[model samples]
Target: MTKELLLAAFIISVGLCVAGAGTHFYQWRLRQQAMLRYDGATVFASMGNLVMSFFCGPYIMLQMGWSQEGGASVNMGSALLSALVAFGWAFLTGLLIVGLYVAVRS
Candidate 1:
């Protein structure tokens, strides 16, 4: 069970990181074409937060598990909740990136 959980965590984190890197790279391309703009720090910070989130996600899910009520099986809700929280955090970081882009372009 523990090994399965560790595997899930590793897969989820790495998957999110890969997806984030791709998204950021696409955004960078758009900025290059003048479709968007942000100072380097903002763009880098946004990307950095994704990396940080990738590392932090599983710890958070497992932490929530401690208080959850799934006796013989994992509570899918906790996983979903953790995913939402993590993505919410990432969304907030994205907002900062958007604000920076607007600040520069406007």
Candidate 2:
């Protein structure tokens, strides 16, 4: 991989992470305002979602064959498909983590 590719990946990954973190923080703040109990499950679910999104987005891009050139060589259709897959994966991963936590707590 060229420096360009590496830089692109890094920028994409960091952007995703920051966005995810911001969303998590907003949710937490909302919960706090509601006087809801802040527990491990809440933290785990939020963090899980962020992590899933952060990694999966770029992964989808890569899996779709997106390269440094950013052109037809990399199938645009495949990129969309990979993005959809990543979306599902991220949602399911968050749900799965919550389920496991509930099971263990019970």
Candidate 3:
């Protein structure tokens, strides 16, 4: 592949990895907060977090317009937006998984 194509792929790959890691980190933070009120279900949460982070990555990248970036910026605003969206997606997915679990268990 040409250098430019390789460079573009590298940037987008880095961005997606960062977004996934950010989401996973957010999940850890949520677990910490949840621990304050209640305990247990760590395994479930971890599994759900993994699934959410893996599945939500593409959506997050699309949200960041990684494909359509036309050479996107490495600026703070873009980075922040990407992280924010990733965290939000992860959080929402976690909630959904928990809710489903509760509903089924009841």
Candidate 4:
């Protein structure tokens, strides 16, 4: 891939991770303020947040084998690595955001 293409991909992947982290933070904060209470709308919104955060990864890597003779095949190793990287990115982002919020509130 060209340098530009790689750079674009990196930006898109990181953006998705950031968005997921933000949504996860929103959901967590909402629930925390509610004191473990769950409303219907909140439940649905939280589920959406979970899905968005869960799938924030290098999904294009999973499609690398799509053009093969057989149907789309996934490389387990790549999938696992992508997941780990995405999770780490989101986790770090979340921690940074929460830490800053706490620091500012103190």
Each model's backbone clash number? 0, 0, 0, 0
lDDT of the structure predicted as candidate 4: 0.49
Steric clash pairs (candidate 2): none
Q: What C-alpha RMSD separates each model from the true structure?
A: 15.5, 15.1, 14.2, 11.3
User: Would you give me the overall lDDT of model 2?
Assistant: 0.49
Q: For residues 10-99, what per-residue lDDT tens digits would candidate 2 score against the true structure? A: 554454444445445645765532111223468787665555444344343334434433454766676677666644544544445445
How do all models score by TM-score? 0.34, 0.32, 0.34, 0.37
Off by over 4 Å in 1: 1-19, 22-74
Where is model 2 poorest over a 10-residue stretch in terms of lDDT?
31-40
Please give, for residues 1-106, the per-residue lDDT of candidate 1 as tens digits. 9997675555545545544564556457655321122235687866655554443443443345445574766678776776677555444544445556679999
Q: Residue 64's C-alpha lDDT in candidate 1?
A: 55
The residue pairs found clashing in candidate 1 are none
The Cα local distance difference test for each model comes to 0.52, 0.49, 0.53, 0.49
lDDT of 4 by residue, 7-58 (tens): 5555555555565554456558666411122234687876754554444322
Deviation of model 3 at 2, angstroms? 51
Highest lDDT model number: 3
* lDDT score for residue 59 of model 1: 42
Candidate 3 local Cα displacement, residue 78, angstroms:
0.4
What residue runs in model 4 are displaced by over 4 Å at the alpha carbon? 1-18, 21-71
